[model samples]
Target: MLLDAKFTIGQRFKHIRIEKGVSQAQLVDGICSIAVVSQIECDRKYPSAELWGKLADKLGVPLRELIGMQEKQMEVSFQIDMVRVYIDKADHTHALELIDELEQRADLLEHQRIELLICRAECYRTARVFEKVVELLVPFLQNQQIRQNVEDVVLCDTYNKLGNAHYWLNDFEKAYFVFNSLDPDDVHFKISNCRCWNTLGNRG
Candidate 1:
């Protein structure tokens, strides 16, 4: 089936809107109702070709620029999703193989690469490969490039996973240190806090 169109209409709309620096209300401009614009941007409805052309014109991008080609990036996303499914099923070896292949082919956007690394690290964690998890994640923590591009949630989760690995390896001191590196307000820190306390209690 034509791969169900790799690019979603909403993603295209949002991308174009960001590129144009136009708000949805501004874009509507009475050509369509604001509610209709909101719906279209949210992918509740696909715009007709006429509307799409109007949007492209206003955004000053070629219509093709708004649409993604169903090629390498889409295939990488599909493979990552499949690996997630396998990971959820506790199929670590299969997921690792898939991740290795996807990582080779993945022309991942910066954020996506960080997410994929976190996912792979979690897979290692699940398999009790504590040292491997640490090895995979520590460099990212030290990486200026990753720090520049990674969101706070991804950073926090990386710290939390690294802490878990240390905890598994009986390195309670390092686990405590890594867990403390996360913000107290972060959700991942909250989850890791409980583990940290439990580990500390046992160590004491």
Candidate 2:
């Protein structure tokens, strides 16, 4: 399973427990300590098979049901991995095709959706389809929940790509604004900034 899939499972597990009115102490009373339960629910640790079975019983669900979630996530992860490979090879046509399929899947967790959008925007940017890149990523970057939930690296990459799209379109004002919004301490941001400067100098 993808690392983000583990995160999704943890978040979904917590949501289910809350909806069922099962307290942390109540859920893990016999199977494990509340600390262990907390760790699992927070994505800090994975549960053992024995623990998974006990938790499933407590929640009145089948173990296979829980396992099924992981399987679906793994399947999605494989497709996303293929998208990355296609992007790396400059195969934007194929990358966009896979991204289109990913966008239609309702089972994708929030982080997965964010990743798909980023990948699609990148394909557009690489193909010199700057208008499409901006159209695709602008709303995603505007969502506060998405910005807060995604990893720093993912966020950085999104900004970098958006900034580059603006730069290519000769929208330097927006490009600078986007680039300046990133953290100065991030190595990715610094590299992106340098690229922007180089592009500007070349034009000058």
Q: Count clashing residue pairs per candidate.
A: 0, 0
With candidate 1 superimposed using the best TM-score fit, by how many Å does residue 35's alpha carbon deviate from the native? 29
Query: For model 2, where is the 10-residue window of minimal lDDT?
Result: 64-73
Q: Model 1, range 1-204, lDDT digits (tens) per residue? A: 122365576766686687678987788785688788788768787565456556766777654455434212445655566556556656687678767766665366766576678779989998888999999987888894444676666677788889889998989888887877767875544554579798778678
lDDT of 1: 0.70
In model 1, the runs with Cα more than 4 Å from the true position are 1-74, 144-146, 186-188, 202-204
C-alpha lDDT of candidate 2 relative to the true structure: 0.73
Reference-based TM-score of each model = 0.59, 0.57
lDDT for every model? 0.70, 0.73
Instruction: In angstroms, give how far residue 9 of model 2 lies from its true place.
Output: 30
